[model samples]
Target: MVIQKKVGFISVLFIISMHSWCQQQINLVDKFQNQKIKAVNRSITLYGDQRDAIELNAENSSGIGIIEDLEFEKGIIEIELLGENNPGKSFIGIAFNIQNNDTYEAVYFRPFNFVAEEQIRKEHMVQYIYHPEFTWRKLRSERTGIFEKGIRIPPDPEDWFKVSIHIKENNIEVYVNDLSEPSLIVDRLSSTKSKKIGVWSGYGSSGRFKNLIIK
Candidate 1:
């Protein structure tokens, strides 16, 4: 009986240790100025009153602030994003399974479309794209509703909102503001592989991101 109890305790300890090892968190606010982040075509600035967030500005084209030394193939990626209500601008989201500056899969949001009166515009609230091949333009023209969809509950475009992305194999699920239902779900256009992840901002857009947790 004593031997069995000792073995059971050891097994429990091993399970807890393995769980901790599998979970990883990136300290975005504390490590903003460090070498952990590599910017690509992005002008990064510290934002928020507490200065706990980082802003990405892209003038002419899309930009990404890639997190260095971390490669993720699947699991959960959660972050808080803030974008302006400026129509035709303000695109903010996350890019993962990245291969390079021009190759990766991304799910972005057009905050201005969140509460648009036009049904067509509202349906464009959230989008997914595999860059360099399946650009937003190509997807919108070719696939249309297959890649983008409207949010069930709209968030203020000018304020912060929590975004949770779940990636499992070829399936991707996105939840906004802790909603019970996902805002969007789409099969990844690219093959599953381990690569870097980044905070992405679209053309002529400026956005703030914080509380980035990867699990």
Candidate 2:
């Protein structure tokens, strides 16, 4: 009888330990920004190669060499981006809604300089593209529902910026590092749920992304 009790106690302890470890792993996925990620590959091309970074050319096209496979039933996507290049008319940000191995949609931010004014403006923007269809549409000003226009979250050009995007059932929230509130929020989207995720760039921009986490 005593031997059975001892065995039962050991089993209980092992179960508790396993539960604790599982909880820790779940928390790690839930809060992805807090972990270190090694780069898997560079540029999602037919030939897979690992490079240090990616560059964007003209005609609004550039992509990270590395691709992460993630599914977001409902949660947040977070990343750290390091920006570079000059004469800055470029779009850089995270992407989702990838379909058919050839097309996807993205929400990107661009740095712009006004002709009349001397000030530089960072454009917080969103775009949807159905590739092969090659249809690209902007999701600012034209679309309604809680979108703040002309808001700038300045990029350091040399430092990493923590960008967090929260996607709930009916809302989207975007934020930069150390900011208590989101820089942009939209309460309504044509589709509130998505699974695919990626990094993107466009038109004369170069950048690096690291520490990507999706929950």
RMSD of each: 2.3, 8.7
For 104-205, candidate 1 gives per-residue lDDT tens digits of 899999999987999999899999999989999999999989899999998998889999999988799999996999999999898866478999999998
lDDT of 2 at 164: 81
TM-score of each: 0.90, 0.58
Model 1 TM-score relative to the real fold: 0.90
Error of 2 at 21 (Å): 8.6
lDDT (10s digit) by residue, model 2, range 1-215: 99999999999999998766533112222222332211222232111143333333334444532243445545677877655434455556776665524455455665332111333133333333334343333333344323433335454545566788776766678777777777777653445234666666665555555566665
In model 1, the worst 10-residue window by lDDT is 27-36
Q: Residue 39 of candidate 2: its Cα lDDT?
A: 21
- Top model by TM-score, which number? 1
Candidate 1, clashing residue pairs? none
> Model-by-model lDDT, in order?
0.89, 0.50
Clashing pairs in 2: 42-65, 43-65, 43-66
Highest lDDT, which number? 1
